[model samples]
Target: MNLYKLGKFLCTVIFYPLYRIKVIGKENIPKDGPVIICSNHISNFDPPVVGITSDRNIYFMAKEELFKNKFFGGILKRVHAFPIKRGMRDRNALRQGLNVLKENHALGLFPEGTRQKNGEVGKGLAGAGFFALRSEATIVPCAIIGPYQKFKPLKVVYGEPIDMTSFRQEKASAQVVTDRIMEEIRQLHKNHR
Candidate 1:
């Protein structure tokens, strides 16, 4: 098996027993197509949990800092994660994200832009919105409940794809689209509560 799947298998072996992970709305995810899985950023473990929970191979848009350490960077690379400089509009990162969609692969990212460990839903960056509208890819809002710690009942809920197709023609700002995405995530988190 490829490193991505291998890593996922190993994670499942560990996550299943440790957290007793629960996933909802798997049926909402399209089996095949370019999709943007956007979720709230709570912890470093959030990405792996969100990615592995889905059946699709997820290519994550991780922060650039995660690549600074060679050893950890190698692991990130093996898991199909690319770096994105947070807090600024990084064109190259955006291009790479769009390319992932153009290739019809799943692109995973945190709309919140950075980790908010407290589990509070915060403002999201427009990157996910830009990718969805530009690539016409479906945006799947995911909500991860509970902490990433062992013995906690971690849950991940994948919401229905947010259709941004109609806004393609209009000049919708990134912030506006991001607001809508964050709202969906909040709703998912609320439903799980």
Candidate 2:
């Protein structure tokens, strides 16, 4: 198996029983075709747990700073994580994301753009909406419920695929679309932290 799948399998075997990770609404994930999985950022544990929400491998746009450490960066690369420079368009990252969608693969994005330290779902940045509108791929909203304390129960809730037809209109903007996506995420986790 490839590194990504192997690592995911290993994590699943270990994390599920250990942490009592609970997953809901996984049926919302498209069984095939391109998809963008938009989730609220909560912990460093977010990617691994959320990636396993579906059996398909998820390619993520990790921040560039995380790639600065050669050893850790190499592992991230091996596991299908690409670096994106935050606070800018980063055209190369955008193109790479589009290409992933073009290939009918699953792409994972944390719309909050970074991990939330306040333990509350925050506003999403424009990146997720930009890709959603550009690729018109299936957008599935997600929320991670956790204080991330070890050996504690954790949950990843997946919401229904967002309807983009209206948002596809000529007047829609990326930031506005992002706001809608974030709202869905917030509702999903409102009962949690």
Candidate 3:
């Protein structure tokens, strides 16, 4: 097991029970192959919450700033978390993400790009859609509802996977594809909200 998997397992064992996490639709996750787990960004804790609840290991694209600290960078590296330069369209980050999906690993993407205090689903960036189309990966829509207060039960809902084969054939623009993916995430949150 990789460091991230080990760390995630340890954290899940230690914190999930204490936090009273309640994950729903976990089976909605694909059993194998590459998939893009698109979710709403509500808090800094969202990534780990979804990561632990997921049956498969998920590699997340974290902002480059998070790796500034040497200690934290080492830990993130173990979990397969990589840094992405926010804004200005970082092609290198996108390339790295594609490699992960090609390897049949789950890639976690927060369409909002950053944590939103209001929990509103902002316009999702084109990266997720682009990667899905490029890698021919399924897009799994996910929503994490409720504040992650200590000992409070949190809800995580994973929706059915959306196939991108059609989108690829249509030669859909990144914005169009991204909007479609974001709508799925929005609907998931709306239902649970």
Candidate 4:
């Protein structure tokens, strides 16, 4: 198996048993076609939590800083993650994301741009919306809640895909679209509470 699939298999075996990981609305995920897995940033475990809960292979936009170490960076790259510079548009990163979608693959990302340790929703950066618009991909709202501690319940909810085609026609601002996406995620969390 490829590195990404291998990692996913290992994580699924380990994470599901180690933690009480409850997944809901998985059927809402589109079985085919390019999709943006837009989610709220929680802890570092957010990616794997969302990744493992879904059947698709999710290519994540990991922060550039995490790739500073060559050894770790290699592993990240092998696992289908690419470096993204945070707090800026970073055109190259944007292009990379669009390319992933153009190939009809799932691109996983956090609209907030970074993790929020407190679990409260934060203002979303415009990157996610920008990618969805450029690639004409549907954005699937997902929410991950819980501590990554052994035996603690970790909840992951996959909401229905938020159509971006209408927004593209209206020429919606990336910031506005991103905020709307975040709101969808927030509502998902609220419903689960």
Candidate 5:
């Protein structure tokens, strides 16, 4: 019962029921070990939606601006959400993400970069792919269907893990690996729909 898990539990108890959330494939999540949970970004609430449904601490890469607010930042920190500069390659953010994986922690990365209102899956950033290749951690592809509005039961479908060990040995290009990861996520979305 660490602070992160506790906060996530509280969030699940409070918000999940109110939203009538229905999470599928909870068993798909690895019971333990370092892993990257890649998902699609729809709304601002998507992060918390995944967090509450997860049984482990999910280190989420949120935009740096979100940390500017003292009150909100405090809460975000409690739930293991960290800041990442939005456009361009932010080395600092990348290092932080790698450290989370090295420490045998779970991370949440939305490959689409930012939220898409059009509901189209966008290109994924190379950050998560790089981390997966370097750490040789498993990559879990997940999909979130529906909005986070009141009475709208958000659906989350978690897919089986994608092993990254081969990528690590072959030293795959970040773009190539990221594209593969994104394609898997897209497939998961299509299957769920």
Candidate 6:
């Protein structure tokens, strides 16, 4: 098995039982195609959880800081994560994301742009929206419910794909698709939790 799947398996063996993770609506994930899994970010733990949501190997757009440490950065790349400089339009990161979709791989993103430590959801950025509209990738909005407290019951609900084909003709902006994605994530939070 590849490092990504191997790491996932080890994480499942090690962390799953400890956190009592409950992954729901995984069936909502498309079995094949270029997919963008947009989710809420709360903690560092969210990345692993997001990767686990899809059966396929998912690439992540992580912050550039995560790659500063040589060892950890190497591990991140080995597991299919690329760095993005936050708060600016990092063209390199953008290209990396587009390439992932162009290759028809699953790309994971946090629409909020960064983590919300207060445990409350935040407004999403327009990045995910740009990706979906540009690549026409299937977007599966997901929510990570419950606290990340040790041994707590943390759940991940992968909701249905957000269809924007109808909105494409109206000259919808990236923010429009982003709002819809966040709405679906919030709905998952409401209905599942």
C-alpha lDDT values of all predictions: 0.86, 0.89, 0.86, 0.87, 0.83, 0.88
Which of the predicted structures, 2 or 6, would earn the higher lDDT when compared with the native? Answer: 2
- Reference-based TM-score, model 4: 0.96
Backbone clash numbers for all candidates listed: 0, 0, 2, 0, 0, 0
RMSD of 6: 1.2
Ranking by TM-score: 4, 6, 1, 2, 3, 5
Candidate 3: global Cα-lDDT?
0.86
Judge candidate 2 against the unseen true structure and give its global Cα lDDT, from 0 to 1: 0.89
Highest TM-score: which candidate? 4
| Cα-based TM-score, every candidate | 0.95, 0.95, 0.94, 0.96, 0.91, 0.96
Candidate 2 vs candidate 5: which has greater lDDT?
2
Q: Which residue pairs clash in candidate 3?
A: 4-78, 4-79
**Evaluated with lDDT, which candidate comes out highest?**
2
Q: Which stretches of candidate 2 lie over 4 Å from their true place?
A: 191-193
Task: For residue 166, give model 5's deviation from the true position in Å.
Answer: 3.1
C-alpha-based local distance difference test score of model 6: 0.88
Give the distance in Å from residue 147's predicted Cα in candidate 4 to where it truly belongs: 2.7
Model 4 off-target regions past 4 Å? none
Query: What does candidate 3's lDDT look like per residue over 1-99, in tens digits?
Result: 767767888879976887788888899898899888999888888888888999888999999998999999888877779999998699888999999
Candidate 5 lDDT tens digits, 1-193:
8777777677788777778888888888887888889888888878888888878678998898999999999888877888988888888888888888888899999988889887656788887788778785678888887766787677788888887777877899887788888888788778876
lDDT of 1 by residue, 1-193 (tens): 9888888888889988899899999888888889889898888888788878999999998889989999999989888898888778888888888888998899998888878878878998777778867886888999988877788798899999897866777868877888899999999999896
Better of 3 and 4 by lDDT: 4
Worst 10 residues of 2 by lDDT: 48-57
**What's the lDDT for residue 172 in model 5?**
91
lDDT tens digits by residue: candidate 4, 1-193: 8888888899899999888899999998887789899989888888877889998888999999999999999999998899988877788888888889998889998988878888887889888778877786778999887667899888898999897878999999988899899999999988886
**Pairs with steric clashes in candidate 4:** none
Query: What 10-residue stretch in candidate 6 is worst by lDDT?
Result: 162-171
